[model samples]
Target: MTVDVEDYFQVSAFEEHISRGSWDDLPCRVEQNVDRILEIFSDQGVKATFFYLGWVARRYPELVRRTRDEGHEIASHGWSHIRATEQTQEAFRQDVSRTKALLEDVTGDPVQGYRAASYSIGRNNLWALDVLQETGYRYSSSIYPIRHDLYGMPEAPRFAFYPVEGDLLEVPVTTLELAGQKFPCGGGGYFRLFPYHLSRWAIQRINQAEGQPAVFYFHPWEIDPDQPRQQNIGLKTRVRHYLNLKRTESRLKLLLKDFHWDRMDRVFLEPAPSP
Candidate 1:
């Protein structure tokens, strides 16, 4: 699962209390909070991976063609949310090649995946994963291997490897290791600061004790608890952007009925056939 389509005043903890030239005079609730997260992932059938934000897809091109005609998986959260360590590799290769050609010209498909605005491509800009595999992009949940004062790398590798030198795939976002440490059980703001049964027992111990598969993420202004709230920020960014914003859509419908989710290019760039 994933979402980060952006716009709680384009949050990078409200980029110094909101102001990318006042983000189009504020008050644009990411198209009614991504149409209530596409009606809670179509009432829990689940199929996510919506990294969006080429300035909210050039102002919601029919909410990215109704989240790609309701099946979901558009990907690419660059172009205006900056921070791939504040860009420079030719401005992060022209912000992921003009947000992957404006989200493949608004959903004609083929926009693989990318997610770096705020997971900021750590360890001194990992060449932004070779400019996301030389701008074709295959995978990148954008590294959040736990160690944060606003983004992490913490010596990377907590899952899906291949940091570079070929077939993309950086993955990272779900961490749970216990006694050896590494804590963030994926999903933004520690899935609203933990306690949804300890993030369903740390995603059922990363799926039955480390068999893997757990990326997870969240954003479309994190279930919009009456959004518009960023004045003079700092009580730890106002309790990490308003703590459990009205219990994040009932803990995301109990994390989509507690597990089995897809669409990071069909659980990491397709090809699971001939079973």
Candidate 2:
């Protein structure tokens, strides 16, 4: 299992609705929600990777430390949640460097993983993988193979592959193929929008039929239904963000009990299991 350790306000969905200038003044709730997540993982005897934003780490060093102390892998979600497609290569490099340094400093371990904000490292910005490689990251889960409005590389490999030859491993989010089209089954809204049985079936298909591990992801705020919702956001964004918030935690509990999950590094970085 994996959790993006960012609050509801920092999400890309509300980037336009809520300005970064007003971020510090907002009510902080990631700590409490993440605590609940840790407790859930603890109860299930599961370990997960938490890809956190650098800005949050600066304010909540104790939260980062607490996550590390709980034995979960600490990874980067960029310095300010900036999408790679919106930044130049040099800018992306600087962002990754800053985030990697901050995460390593906070955890006292080599930060080996990265998941781009909004999965924005798509075809136009595959160079982001090169930047990640040069910045010393071992793997990234930034690209989603299915097509989407904000981000995707639909024709990309569904399972783990090295996008930059040998420098970095690109573990695109999980997808299920049907009628020759790739569908988004990785997690996030798809997990919320669809029935639990659908996600369960997709992962089972990936494991049994495709013979690969599923890389599912969710956010800390997903389990927090009462989180302050922004009113000025677009109707589409509001619906996608707010739909099924109350059901997430319960579904996650069932997901954990049903499947064996581990950090991205261990699952992809390690040798492939014999087919």
Alpha-carbon RMSD to native, per candidate: 17.8, 1.6
Write out the backbone clash pairs for model 1.
219-222
Off by over 4 Å in 2: 272-275
Against the hidden reference, what TM-scores do the models get?
0.32, 0.97
Which stretches of candidate 1 lie above 4 Å from their native place? Answer: 3-47, 51-66, 71-73, 77-88, 95-97, 107-120, 126-141, 146-152, 155-172, 183-200, 204-255, 259-275
Clashing pairs in 2: none
Q: Across residues 1-275, which tens digit of lDDT does each residue of candidate 1 receive?
A: 88888878777877876779878887798898899889988988998888998988988888998988988889898878878877689988998899899889888888988888888888887887888898898888888888888888777879887877888777778889878789888777778988799888888889898887888888878788887776777798889888998998899899899887988888766763111
Cα lDDT tens digits for candidate 2, 1-275: 68888889999988888889999999989999988998999999888889999998988988999988988889999988888888999999999999999988887899999999999988788888888988899889998888788888898988888777665788878999999999988789999999999999999999999988898899999999999878877879988999999999999999999999888767776763222
Q: Over the full model, what C-alpha lDDT does candidate 2 score relative to the true structure?
A: 0.89
Give the per-residue Cα lDDT of candidate 2 at 242.
96
